[model samples]
Target: MKKNYFILLFILIITSQACGVSVKYSFTGTNLDPRVKSVQIDYFPNNAVLVEPSLSQTFTTNFRDLFLTQANLDLVDSGGDLQFEGEITGYKINPMTATAEQTAAQNRLTITVNVRFYNNIVEDDNFERNFSHYYDYDADTQLIGSALDDAFEEIIERISQDIFNASVAKW
Candidate 1:
């Protein structure tokens, strides 16, 4: 009887502790305040010196998709509880490494976006900054076809995630 009584007490204590924990946990690791309900993201035009025709559209779509998939917040057209506005500011190709012949061995493709985030509920949380990401490929290979596509995909994914973390995730 004493053993059963102790087990019951232990279970009760654990349940009570769980109830006292107020944080609402989700798979995306966002601890969004309860008052925030909606988000807005403006079209991010590519203003880079070297513009990829589809980059703006692809990035804008991906940026919006991240919030939609990861957070429970509704996407609003304007004046949302949280907002994101940005433009691609830089795109460059640079040689990263040299080969035995003193020529380029690897080249890096980099993209940068200037982001402005607004959090109406918490004014102090808003920020404007640049986020950049890059991918490196063999110098001999031209950045075209599948290679170029893959580089864009990788860089865009990273930049979008960084933006999401900064504006919403607070990471």
Candidate 2:
């Protein structure tokens, strides 16, 4: 009798835990749908005038990592429930302002990315959008290349976060 009681108690505990625990924000006004299990992200093509050899790979990897860390989803190459493709459309540097001597004092570096997201399970959520950000560089500052690289990293990070929130955060 005690053995049967313990088995029943264990089963009850498991069932109660499963029922009590919920995935917060897994759904937006709708119940959590288990149709989507895996995701696939393609390499973002860089079509910007100033082509950085590693920019495409960096963006793609960062995007995949963001989704992996933020959402309870898998990453697959093909036949995934979700897929994303994109291109780096713009990369430019322009003078920001004039100095006291009437010369260029600061520069603005801008990067733009266009992304298309598809939820194979839900066609309505699929869409394409372009995102851009800029960083300012002072003429007085040295190491312009490194500074620009850092800025690019930050911009890509923000973009990745925005994409994740838009797709999975359901906000």
Highest TM-score scorer: 1
lDDT of 2 by residue, 1-171 (tens): 999999999999887775543434443332224677788999899999898787888888888888777667788888878888889999887889997898889887778999898988777778898888777878676524777578778889888877776665654
lDDT (tens digit, per residue) of candidate 1 on 50-99: 99998899899888888899988899999899999989999999999998
C-alpha positional error of residue 29 in candidate 1 after TM-score superposition, expressed in Å: 1.2
The regions of model 2 sitting more than 4 angstroms off are: 1-32, 141-145
Q: Rate the local accuracy (lDDT) of all candidates.
A: 0.89, 0.78
Clash pairs for candidate 1: none
TM-score of 1: 0.84
Error of 1 at 101 (Å): 2.0
TM-score, every prediction: 0.84, 0.76
Clashes of 2: 0
Candidate 2 local distance difference test against the native = 0.78
Q: What is the C-alpha RMSD of each candidate to the true structure, in Å?
A: 3.0, 5.8
Clashes of each: 0, 0
- Model 2 TM-score? 0.76
